[model samples]
Target: MNEIVRIDNLSFRYMQGLDNALEKVNLGFEKGAVIGITGPAGAGKSTLLSCINGVIPHYMNGDLQGHVLVNNQEVANLTFGQLAPIVGTVFQDVDFQTVSITVEEEVAFGPENIAIDPAEIENRIIHALESTHITTLRRRAISTLSGGQKQRVAIAAVLSTLPDLLLLDEPTSELDPIGTQEVFEAIFELNKTLGMTVIIVSQKVENLIDCDRIIVLSDGKVAFDGQPRKVFMRSQRLAEVGIAIPEVTAFIIALHKKLGQPISTERLPLSIGEAQTTLENILRQYGVLS
Candidate 1:
């Protein structure tokens, strides 16, 4: 896979702060991969996302150092107009990304602003709404939608721009369990079907179960970056940094301790079905279950 985004020796400090929000960060994301960014509060996950979208030095005043490259172009040097085509960001709060009242208008807003051909705008709007599974809500008022519906609409709005990379900040933070699942399902489809590079900053570990890799941040630096299973295996290290593994992984860990089993933590499962299968096999072998 080609590198869709890169961060090299990146550092940023807010106007009121002396310490950098990000420090010497280095990372790369592959095209068509879903990468999850997680850490304790104020660990610079949001800052890093902003850097990728060129919002830090351009929209917000701050001291910034290092390079953020989207599609091999430096983000700091790119104008908002220039970055719009390559990177689209859906904020944690959907309200911030909303511009029009109706769902169709909101999805068409970005393409319209860029002066895309009217026919192309219609096609993009239809494609985005269909991609996000919000086609039925095209003419509905944005205010009438639920939080999850609003989130889907927000994502659809960004997709309408046909960005190569999508950045989501706590995309499911305001959602219920079902809502979260709906959003994740939509995200999975987007990544698998559209081959869009996805970078998501989220605290919800379960939502990241399907991510190709999970990058854990701490003190504005890269602490862990690898497969989700590998990262979840370090439950202790993650806890020390105020991050939690998926519920199923946590359950297996506790079961292993209670049953005195020597299960490999490194092989911890991410989903409930996997955990159940593993547990059943172990229990049957030990004659605990027939």
Candidate 2:
């Protein structure tokens, strides 16, 4: 997979800050991968997202150091107008992004601003609504939608621009369990079927466990970057940094600590089904279960 994003020795300090919000952060994201960024509050997760979309130095007042490259183009050098088509961002607050009264208008807003051909704009809106599973809601008013539906519309709005990389900040922060699942299902489907690279900034560990990669940030730096299975294993360190481990992994860790079962690290269980299967196999081996 080609590298879609690259952050090299990146650091930034806001106008009122004494220290950098992001400190010497070095990382790269692969194309067509769903990557999760999570950490405690003040971990610079949002700052990292801003850099990818060329907002750090261009739109926001900040002291920036090092570089951020999207699709091999340096962020600092790209104008917001130039970057808009390359990177699409959905902020944490869905309400803040809601501009149009109707879902169809909302989804078409971005593409229209870019002066895309009228025929192409129509196609983009249709594809975006379908991709985010919001086709039925297109004729409805945005204010009448549920929290999850609003989020889906926000994502669809960004998707209409046909950006190569999508960056979301706490998309499900205000959603219920079912609502969260619906939004994530749409996101993962896009990544899997459409080959769109997605980077989501969230605090929900369970929601991120199945991503192709999970990056844990601390004190404005990357403390862990790898597959979800490996990152979840550092329960102690993650807890110290104020990042909670996924419940399933936490339960398995406790079992290993208490029983000395020597659980294999090859494929640590991240979900209930995986945990159940692993536990049953272990019990069977010990003659405790058939």
Candidate 3:
């Protein structure tokens, strides 16, 4: 896989006297990957994203060590304006990010600032709105939209920039279940259809379960980096770090423990459909089902 982002021996502190927020972190993310970053509060999850998007040294005051490279260009070498072209970041608060009164202007903000051609900007806005399923809300006032609609509008605004890397920080933290699903679906479609490299920093483990890869941060260090099943296998360690395994995977793991029959790691299920199939297969093996 082509490497889209790389962090090498990364460490950072907010001020000279402060303790490191991130400590000796090393990671390489492949292009077009759907990556979930989860950890407890103050675990350096947001700090990591800041590093990726050039917010660490550029906009925020920080003492830094090591390098953050996006598309092989070191983040420190790029100005905030320079980094804006390659990375689009949607912060946790949708309300705070919205400045334009109407959805159309909001979505077009980034592209317009970058001086994209008028025709191209319109095309980008339309494509972004359609991609996020908010075309009908284009003329609506930003304040009139619901949580899900606002989140989608924020994503659409980021999408208008047409960035190669999309970083969202706890996008659904304030959303209801339906809104969460809506935001996630838009993100998944962007990954699947546009092949955009997406890194989402979320506390919601259930939402992270289906990601292509999950990175667990603990005390500013990577505690786990692997498939969802492998990550769940370290449930005890995750809990120690204040991270929870998804409920479905937890239940399946419990069953395997009680049966004294180890379940194949490859067959571990993260979703209901997969769990159902795995359970049915197990029943057949035990002659509980014909």
Candidate 4:
């Protein structure tokens, strides 16, 4: 019942373009849920986030139909100043959102712009730096941070606003594996401790294995939307559309096939750790070993 964002009959087209960037999309997100959005290029994933965060009709030149609501308030009805506290977005390019030279300053920028009390702004900056595990880097110049660190800094900057929903646009796409892990750890940790709802767009399927839900868009429409397991159960369907289910999920499916029975999607593992536990249990259940 605590839905944070809702989209109703939404559709949009660039002012000069011929096709709708999004088409009649209807979706809802619950508070504290970590949902992953995935699909091919130009599939409206970013556009969807833009709508919820008031970037579509308010800032961008687009023909938008329908509406997006954040915390039951229409996004388009709210001013940018009003929406900043309800939703925060981190785009693929961290530089766009990060303006200050130092990590601490970057984190403080959002609250400062909103004219929060100085004491409250300082407290929010401290909380954000700690939440993102970048306390040691607080005074470090933004130019010296690695891609991962920079992304974390950007996230902390957004967190400073204490938004209810966080919109991530491929924040980890350009990071190395370790960097990717670092960013996800910070994000999921914040999601756990702060009870923040997150909507992340990524083509990195495996990383999304832990998401509560995966929504796949194809050609500006909702082609698949369900729990991770339920959506990945359509592995073949995903592959046909140039999307690969996680390698771990594929291995589990193959193992089930080798046993002459299909494993229930409910029992499949989306991650390597889960796969190990599942396989061990299966061997023990079949009396293969102690």
Best by lDDT: 3
| Tens-digit lDDT track of model 1 for 1-290 | 58998889998999998899999999999999999999989999998998999888898988898888888889888899998888899987789779899999999999987789999999999888876778899999999999888988998898888788999999877777876787778777888888988998898888787899999999999999999988888899999999989888899988888878756745687899999988898789899999
Model 3 Cα displacement at 53 (Å)?
0.9
Instruction: Point out the worst 10-residue segment of candidate 3 by lDDT.
Output: 173-182
Candidate 4 accuracy as TM-score: 0.93
Superposed Cα deviation of residue 199, candidate 4 (Å): 0.9
Model 2: per-residue lDDT, tens digit, 9-95?
Answer: 998999999899999999999999999999988999999998898778887998899989999989989899988887899987789
Q: In candidate 3, what are the lDDT values of residues 41-73, reduced to their tens digit?
A: 989998999899887888788789999899999
Q: What is the C-alpha lDDT of each candidate?
A: 0.88, 0.88, 0.89, 0.88
- Against the true structure, candidate 2 has what lDDT? 0.88
lDDT of 2 at 72: 92
